[model samples]
Target: MLTILVTGATGNVGQEVIRLLLNQNCQVRAAVRNPDTATEILSVHPTAGFSDHSIDRVPFNFTNPATFATAFQGVDKLFLVRPPNLANVRKQIAPALEAAKRAGVKQVVFLSILGADRNPILPHSKIESYINRLGIPATFLRASFFMQNLNTTHKEEIKTRGELVLPAGHGRTSFIDVRDIAAVAVRTLMEDGHSHKAYTLTGGEALTYYEVADIFTAVLGKPIHYTNLSVWNFIKQMRDRGLPMDFITVMVGIYTTARLGLASHVTPDVEQLLARPPLTVRQYVEDYRQFWL
Candidate 1:
């Protein structure tokens, strides 16, 4: 069995990727930060029908370099997720890449943002380029904005205020499902012909926030609205809400990028690779009903 280590295994994408890998009866490892996440995964793993796989649940913190070796031990494949914390996040990625290289891991799938490999304005794009130039065999899944983000965090605002507000004006984004992203990641980790390739995965439609709101209202049978605030106003709102400067900066940059139409367009890869059509916004709204409840 191929030994695979899934870092950030407790995350939205990580959990799904780990589940998909385990379903194949592969030797699966979950690298989590706490025993609670491990315990939760263990309880659900068998019920999810993955108890037969080699379940190596290990603790690995991005800030702690000493634990890297132990988690990398006997590992042949890797699925890397960026830690949620932005402080020293870049500093941590290179070392982890080095450790993966040292461990002789065959292929690494990075959950990178769309346009990260090409957008010169965003720092993540530079990091993605640097990783591409490295000696190791790596694949960057430059995924679009996850639809799940809106479900959890943005949904609160939408439900309370009846509006979806952002800085992008008349610009569209190919908001994708994290579930689809996980499926692609698992396929890349398990299959061949994916190395040296950067896949730009997206939902089937490119939609502006207004159009997105309309879609939600149509699907969910409720009134939803879109407020296109100026970038400064958006920053002020976030800052007034006590968001960190780093987060505010990145979010402003993302909106700026979107205003320039960076995130627009649909890709055929999702349907081609998965042998199914990517979920529609209607489906996303249905999924959000569960999230809201």
Candidate 2:
């Protein structure tokens, strides 16, 4: 049986990846910051039909190189994800990759951002370039804005306040689903034909802020509005909301660059990999309706 190490195993994509691999009866080592939180986290996923499989919730901290010594032992594959703190990536991912390579891990599937090559100063790009240099079997899965992102803070705010605010002027996004991202990652890690492959994972269709608002209205059965503010205005709004300056800068850069025709490109890669159609926005809205209210 192939053993896989899953970094960030409790996050959105990581959680989905873990569930899928477990369904396939793969030996999974969940590298978490805390083992005690693992059971509670899986319980919340509500994997009603999922069969129990072997899961080792090991304490692994990316910034701590010593933790990787034990975490990478006997691992064949890794689902690599940089934590939410963009600033700490160098202190984390750089060392983890080295440990995986040293452990003789066969394959590595990385979750990176779209257009990572364009902005060298961007943390996502920096990580992408770093991973690209490693002389190992690597797959970089570059993804655009996720619809699931909205399903979090964006959805709550919209449901509570009836407003969608952002600095994406006239920029449209074909937001990929986290489920699709997970599918690509799992397929890359477990199957053949994906080594050294770079994929731009995207949504089935591109939709602007106005179009997204229409979809929201149809699903929630309530009026919703999309406001496209200037980049400066968006930055100001986020700052006022108490977001960190570094993250706000990154978000604004992504938003403005996206407006210039970066993430608007649609790709059929998800369908190609999954052997079926990717989920549509309306379907996502319907499936997650309970959260919208």
Best by lDDT: 2
CA deviation > 4 Å runs, candidate 2: 46-53, 88-90
Kindly list the per-residue Cα lDDT of model 1 for residues 50-127, writing each as its tens digit.
453346788887777887899898888888887755435457677777777788888888888787766665555655
Q: Please write out the lDDT profile of model 2 over residues 163-268, one tens digit for every residue.
A: 7887776777878888889988998888888988889898889888888889999889998888888888888888888888877776777778667767698998
In candidate 2, which residue pairs clash?
none
Model 1 CA deviation exceeding 4 Å by range? 41-55, 87-90, 120-123
Q: lDDT for each of the candidates?
A: 0.78, 0.81
Task: Report the Cα lDDT for candidate 1.
Answer: 0.78
Error of 2 at 92 (Å): 3.1
- The ten-residue window of minimal lDDT in model 2 covers 45-54
lDDT of 1 at 35: 53
Clashes of 2: 0
